[model samples]
Target: MTENDKPAEAHEQDGTQLARENWERYQYCVSRGHRDYTRLASRLEGFYLGGGEQWSREDLEILHEQGRPAYEFNEVMPAINAAVGYQIHNRMDIAFRPRGGDATKELAEVRTKVAKQIADNCRLHWKETEVFGDGMIQQRGFFDVRMGYDDAVLGELSISVLDPLDVMPDPDAKSYDPKDWADVTVSKWLTLDEIEGQYGKDARLRAEGARALGDEDFGEGDDDGTSRNKFGWQDTGRYDAEYAGGGPRRLRVIDRQKRVLSQMQVAIFPGGDVRQLAGDEKPEVLEQLRANGAFITRRMMKRVRWIVSTCDALLHDTWSPYDRFTVVPFFPYFRRGKTRGMVDNAVGPQEALNKAVSQYVHIINTTANSGWAVEQDSLTNMTTEQLEEFGASTGLVVEYATGKRPPQKIQPNQVPAGVDRIIDRAAGTLKEVTVPDAMRGTQGPETSGIAIQSKQFAAQQGLAVPLDNLARTRAMVADWIDYAITKYYDSERVFRITKTDPLSGKEVEEELTINQWVPESGGYLNDMTSGEYDVVVTEQPMQVTFENGQFQQAMEMRGAGVRVPDSVVIRHSNLTDKHEIIQQMEAASATPPDPLAEAEAVLAQARARLAEAQAERARAEAVNKSIEGMFSSAQTATLVAQNPAIATAADGMWKSAGGIDKDAAPAIPSIDAPAVAPPEQNTNPLTPANPSVGMNAGIEGGQP
Candidate 1:
């Protein structure tokens, strides 16, 4: 029990000797002569101090004593025998410890337990044999049992339980037994080489190669068809035969990192098909069914179903949560069934929608092989004007009806010859022409002409004509027959005049006599002359007939019964040459002058005189104003005098005003007149008037 005293059990057998050597080696490797031996030595002491146990020197000594028996047995036996009963099992590929507390014994125990677990859990239906040493002992072994636990092949088995004897030891010589063993069954076991081989299959996991068994053995084949064997296995028959036949085998290692499972689930239900549940209901019902989920409340089943289905189909390909949910219905839900739900409300009417869709389709077809078609309902509920506008956008012509008969068409060549006359008659009498500019020339050119003429005639006659009068008269008289035909017969009644005679050429002269019955209100002619004739009574009777053709006549029948006979007779006495008198009378007759021509000539002469007088008066006024302004500004006067023409004109004016004498006329200041210098007698006879001095004074005293 002393620190330096070797355990008596250490020399008991080869197993005990081996255990002692291993313990010494472990202690030596960990200590390295360090002072912190307490912390380092704790693990080899075989009990966790803080987890579930406290340290006691006596208990430690007992544990050492108890381990001695298994140690002695281990020292006496070969190392391979310890693995005889072991099997690999479980998902972690670990094994159980031996029944004894000996370190070597425990190692063998772990191997044996692992092998047994593997044989118990795996579906192993094959056997293999290996002979040893001079054919002395031959053994055929069947491993990896055909039976499996919970449908899983046992890959590895691990034991974690500690023996009570490992914590405490007996003083007497005794065999040790482990109380309990923690067992773990692995679904797979992989050596570093196997893991590495898997990594070669998929280079993405190359970093995990160290944990694979097959990867350690993978290399170029040798001449014997055997490669390097870097990994050791306890059981491996569970894999398929193809996988087992290769010199070096590989097992697929799924990436643990990539095997992520989402904890949340999203289900889509078709609109109103979703079941309504109260707060007390279980959510599991909705979670399980395909028809019980939706983010929106459904009022209409079919529409909601379509929307949800669309969303589901879209989300099936994308992995984002954002794409999985539908915020609003795919088709807009307008409360009042009005097509109003658009991304931008500014796109106002459904007609605009139709236009937009049409344009979009056109663009798509032009740019690509898209077979888009425009639907009429896209312009639902649009007015006539809106429809026309929409049609115009796509270069389509539109026809709108006013819900009445279409307008009549008029022809160009079929216009009546007498349409002008008809229009004249109708417009003059009826006054019913109100055609607009577009209708005027289109209805009938001759008809329009007749209308204009009729209007003119009515104005000349000084009569107020009713609108329908001329139309009625024209229709009754069959006037404008061709125009009527054109107006009534053509599809598009647009009339054009092909040829026409000048209106002036169509004029006719006709004399019309109008009798005026005046009731005491006398009438006077505007422009007329009176003529008087002198008759002489002779021996031969002369007779004359008078008529009221050119003058007003009055007949008086008095109480004396005086009668002015219709025919008057006068008798002439001496013989006279009647032919000579008739010739004289014929020679005396004269044609009257054209009064209009005379008036026009007189007006022209008056205009010419007035124009000449205006020009003369303008010149006189301009000259007078210039003269008056000249006295106001000395500069102006000086400027005028400097020019020869202006100076001459001024001189003429001064003379015309009877010369600028101080006594005879008011003083008119002259801008260019030299300043009056004091009289200086000429000292030198050659210096006449001292012109240089005067010129110098003029230059210096010049007005600005």
Candidate 2:
């Protein structure tokens, strides 16, 4: 059968009218985005880089001639963007607060660990979102966070931020002030790839690819099986030649434009959450699970991708990918004096100031260049061509000497009065809208302490609305991270766990099974899923810590008479990462010092001293007994013969009294006392006092 005779099936999409219908809807969303962002992108870039089409032609010429202008003194918008960006980048703190049944401490801690790990990994990504979002929040006045899971492809969960310009809600929408999207949020991005990758290698994608080829040039030669008319016009490739602009054309009329649209619509159902339901009420709610569906379509040029997918969201069981994800929309400086994000607060003042500065620069250059009119008399020597050259190069005009005039300055609005004033006034307006002068470090010395503080507070207050939103964003991101890990990161991961090792107290890194950390599971991390969780975006208060950190703080508190544990101190110290070691230190410090143990230590020393004293006493006693036996006779004689002052009666047998004191005392033994005559009576017969050298030794060490 001929190509047309083969019916619609011979073409692409396998005859599905549904795909075509979806393509039409996607086209509308994409067109809306293009319309909204067409001017916005260029405007934001103009502010950032200092040029835009909105500037007058003269201004553009000046800028084009000058390249980038030095007149972009309006750093206020950037300063605001930077100030908010820095805060979010450095201090977008968050915590995983569990809700519903899984809110126990065990689960909370597990989720916290999971959240921390995820945060550590995705912190940069989140900040990047904030940084770009800050610009949008400052420029367009709103931004959003889009979360997804493709770990099999991305290695971990992903949070792809949708650029504010691409976030198309509704064309008639006055503001991005929806409290919640009871319906849907559509995101559109243009891809330059000729092949639609989202559809894998499907027939529909192949069809779009074929359409994008632009021309069908199958060989006109007879051998290639393509026919050529007498006029030499060749038929388009494989498909039937009956159609115009190539047969089986896949792209739609709107898609014909070079930009292809990748449209993702997250349609949240009204009742995806049933946590509040009674136990018996759950079964009925599950029946409506299909209501929480998400649709992603890849439209290539005029054609629609065949493989459009719709799935039940694991997150919130809604049309959202973030059952665990959060959309932390930032509108730190929302207008309307309300909490919702509005069009750029600085848009008006900023654009005004940019124009004023550019013009001021141009005027200043003009005044400096053409201020003096050249004397025509001086140019008389030069030709017309030479004078023209001089005029063009110097921006000066030639004047005839009219009785002449010397070269004089030409003053436009010679008063020049309002020029500076206008420029200064514009600058002031821009500055007023921004917070670099207050919330940041640029406070002037003349600014009083109270004023400075007030400014800071005002700056903080200004951010309050967005901060609140960011907090929600953080909580959602954190919750989603936990959810992602629980659901996706099931493999063994050596998670850093902080706790005391029962035996030693000090900070340390210990690994806990991811599954065990999560409250409900005693299994591996893979075994667990974040069944349900709640997230809380919090600005973790910057603790006033000394250079010594938590450790120093702990020491100071201790010095101040406040008892604090080393581990607790470590938590505040540089050893925060070593939580386990700190915990161990805390555990060890908690045990009370043992009084009985101290007593035992003292008793052991006392016993050693007593043993030494006994040995000395024994030696003294043995020596005294031996001396009495040896010196009895001579001592007795000496005691009897000497006067009482010089000699007293000796008690030992070896130290008896002199002169027969033995007879008076009932015959103490005296063998050979030299008779009391002359030199011999000096008791030479008495042996030296005996000392029992071996006595103490024998008593102590069994010496002979």
Best by lDDT: 2
In candidate 2, which residue ranges exceed 4 Å CA deviation? 1-15, 30-34, 51-59, 62-70, 96-99, 124-155, 170-198, 203-343, 358-415, 444-455, 482-507, 514-533, 541-704
Residue-wise C-alpha lDDT for candidate 2, range 53-151, written one tens digit per residue: 335457667667765463455454465564545455445555555554324556666666666665566554456455445444434323343334444
lDDT of 1: 0.27
Query: TM-score of model 1 relative to the true fold?
Result: 0.11
Error of 2 at 236 (Å): 29
- When summed lDDT is taken over every stretch of 10 residues in candidate 2, the lowest stretch is 309-318
Candidate 1's clash total is: 80
What are the per-residue Cα lDDT tens digits for candidate 1 across 1-704?
Answer: 56237564542233334323433332342243211322222221212112211224464476457542111111101111111101111011222322212224433332323233332333221111111000001110101111112332321221111111111111121221110111101112243365444334333233232233233323223111222223534233334334676443443221110011233333334432232222222353332242223442323211111000010011011122111111111111122211111111211221232233333434433333212233333433454446544432544443334453422222223333454444334333221212222212233555655465444333323211211222222221121121111111211112122222222112233321112223576531110001111111111111111222111232323234655332211111122443344344445554566899899999999999999999999999999678655544554354454543445555566678776555633233334544444334444534533343421133323322
Question: How displaced is residue 172 in candidate 2, in Å?
Answer: 7.2
Residue 529 CA error for candidate 1 (Å)?
Answer: 99
Per-residue lDDT for 156 in model 1? 24
lDDT of 2: 0.45
What local distance difference test score does each model get?
Answer: 0.27, 0.45
